[model samples]
Target: MIHVAQITLETKGPRLLFLRKEDPVRFTWYEDLVQEEKETEVFSTTALEAIRLAYLYWKNYSFKTLNCGFRYTLPERDEHGNNALFHQMIASYSSMNGIYFDEDLGHNCFVNFASDEAKNLWKNLQSQKRL
Candidate 1:
């Protein structure tokens, strides 16, 4: 399972903290993330709760945004005999006048997840809506 520790969002985008559940020892720590990402915020929790909590806060200020989008990791394997880190992302923009045009950006993309549970966790996050 992927343990979501913290989530930080700025004018740029959202940053999520996660740790490989079963392989904490060999969990390769990646540096090069932004300054807001801190090791001190590790909550050792799941993605659902983290996302739910974030939605509560983001919705308060993101009033102009009427639509939400998400990316989900796929479970299929690639030709290398390894789990393919494919992902899907979709977007639906709503206008104040009620007109809308959607985009399925997930058409061609690859993603990396800590584990299979991370994929399931992302699906749960997608089910939640604030607007």
Candidate 2:
């Protein structure tokens, strides 16, 4: 089986074992009612790494952003200004879903982990307008 983990405060819950169980509304947004198939995140091995990837993904949140709409645009501050969009989106979509172990999809057996404090930290950072 592929062992994967996510760093989130919600370590012990149904989410720990299930994918796309965070927000039913959001999940349904991308699901096909006829097929009953829902969209889910590709987790990583570390929470921070996962959040970092999410941040980059949010930075380039656009149509055809990437495979499955996940992009990895680095958050860099140039003469223009800080790249706050990525941080903002990450915070907005913060959800500390936990680890997962899947027997299928051997190649993606392991992905980066998401921080336990990703949701909270992102919320706080957003509140402070740090992003």
Candidate 3:
């Protein structure tokens, strides 16, 4: 099961405090802590919430001019595998605007912004120090 937590734009921007400043997209997965384990892998809590908020705010400010798209993949794993996989994709009307988050059930999560528009929106959200 994929669990997602979201923050609405109308709410004060303090919710982003949960994220680390130098790297807002990456966060520790507190629920997965196993003291006995020799190693713990840090992960994103799924940046869907942040991305959605930014997308909504951008969409509103853009007068709903462009259509955005979202794709979700269910968590899955092979019977012989020990971990599950999760994936998410977002795109805008223009092929130039999009982002991809591939959480491969490991320490190295991949994030890519297809265009500057998508990158700017993420930056704008993270930089909201007062709003």
TM-score of each: 0.23, 0.19, 0.22
Least well predicted 10-residue stretch by lDDT in candidate 1? 85-94
Counting only residues 3 or more apart in sequence or on different chains, how many pairs clash (N, Cα, C under 3 Å) in candidate 2?
15
Q: Number of clashes in every candidate structure?
A: 1, 15, 0
Model 1 regions more than 4 Å off: 1-44, 63-131
**Most TM-score-accurate candidate:** 1
Q: Encode model 1's per-residue lDDT on 1-131: one tens digit a residue.
A: 23343333466454444333224333211111543323322222443443344346445434121112232323432434222211221221112432223223233233333344444445654564300
Computed on alpha carbons, the lDDT of every model, listed in order, comes to 0.32, 0.29, 0.29
**Cα distance off (Å), candidate 3, residue 53:** 16
| Candidate 3: residue 37 lDDT (0-100) | 15
- Model 2 lDDT per residue over 1-131, tens place: 11112222233321111122233222111211232434445344543344355445433332111111121222221233222222223522442431122222122111132344444534554576533
lDDT of 3 by residue, 26-67 (tens): 533212112221211324445444334444543533211111
Candidate 3 runs further than 4 Å off? 1-104
Best lDDT among the predictions, by candidate number: 1
